[model samples]
Target: MKILVVDDEEDVKSLFEQKFRKEIRNAQFEFSFAFSGEEALTYLADHPSEVVMILSDINMPGMSGIELLKSIRKDYPAAPPQVMMITAYGDSQNHNQAMQLGADDFLTKPVNFIELKEKLLKTL
Candidate 1:
């Protein structure tokens, strides 16, 4: 599966690469990184039907993940890519908002790789 990971943190790319190294080596998941929500939109625009899922950080600098989620839901209402929002703050307000905006799932940061892998497998 092709997954787009969006976050403001530059280290996120390396972290994901390290965490999912085995799956990547096995060709189970293909990942693309975007440093910002705007960049994620650009990537999505360029590769409309390529991405199967998006893992986005909710508290970004410019456009927040909630805003990104809203835009994606609005733009691709028919067949939107599955979106899972991640955040350091596990507040109900953020979680509720994301759920209302059509988020497929919500994950709290310091993410549990084991849980994430299980969820990804379920999707497959």
Candidate 2:
């Protein structure tokens, strides 16, 4: 399965890639990255089912993760990907909004790689 890890931070992107490298060998996961939500959408439009899950940072420049989730839920309703929102703050309002927008899960910053892996496992 393929997973899209979306975040503005370079370190987070690098960490996710490194952490999932071994799993990629087994085809347990193939990873992709998007520095912003709009880029993520563009990537999805081009690759479609190549992605199974989207791990996104909530606060981003062009489009927030919330916007990305809503767009997918609406435009790709038939098989919208499971979105896992990531943020540094645990804002209840954003959390509720994410849920309403169809996010499958949420994670705070300083992403725990192990937990992220398990969550992706559940969705895949």
Candidate 3:
């Protein structure tokens, strides 16, 4: 499955790559990384319907993840990619906002890769 990961942290790409190395090598999962929400939108526009899921961080320099979720939900209302929000803040406000904006799932950082993997598998 193709998954897009959006975060401002440059190291996140390496972290996810390292954590999912086995799945990636086995061709079970393919990942694409975007450092900002704008970049993510550009990628999606360039490759429509290619990404199956998105793992996004709520806080960023430019457009916030919530705004991204809103855009995705609006632009692809009929068949939007499954979105899972990831943030260091695990507050009710963020969670509620994400759910209200059509996020499929919510995860807190220091993300548990094991849990994320399980959830990803279930989507298949």
Q: Write the per-residue lDDT of candidate 3 for residues 1-124, one digit (tens) a residue.
A: 9999999999999999999999999999999999999999999999899999999999999899999999999888776899999999999999999999889999998999999999999997
Candidate 2's TM-score reads 0.92
Ranking of all candidate structures by their lDDT, best first: 3, 1, 2
Could you arrange the candidates by TM-score from highest to lowest? 3, 1, 2
Which residue pairs show backbone clashes in model 3? none
What's the TM-score of each model vs. the native? Answer: 0.97, 0.92, 0.98
Clash tally, candidates in order: 0, 0, 0
lDDT of each: 0.95, 0.84, 0.95
Question: lDDT for model 1, on a 0 to 1 scale?
Answer: 0.95
**lDDT accuracy of residue 54 in candidate 3:** 97
Alpha-carbon runs more than 4 Å astray in model 3: none
Clashing pairs in 2: none
- What CA RMSD would candidate 1 show? 0.7
Off by over 4 Å in 1: none
Candidates 1 and 2 compared: the better one by lDDT is 1
Ten residues in a row with the worst lDDT in model 2? 9-18
Looking at model 3, residue 26 earns an lDDT score of 97
Better of 1 and 3 by lDDT: 3
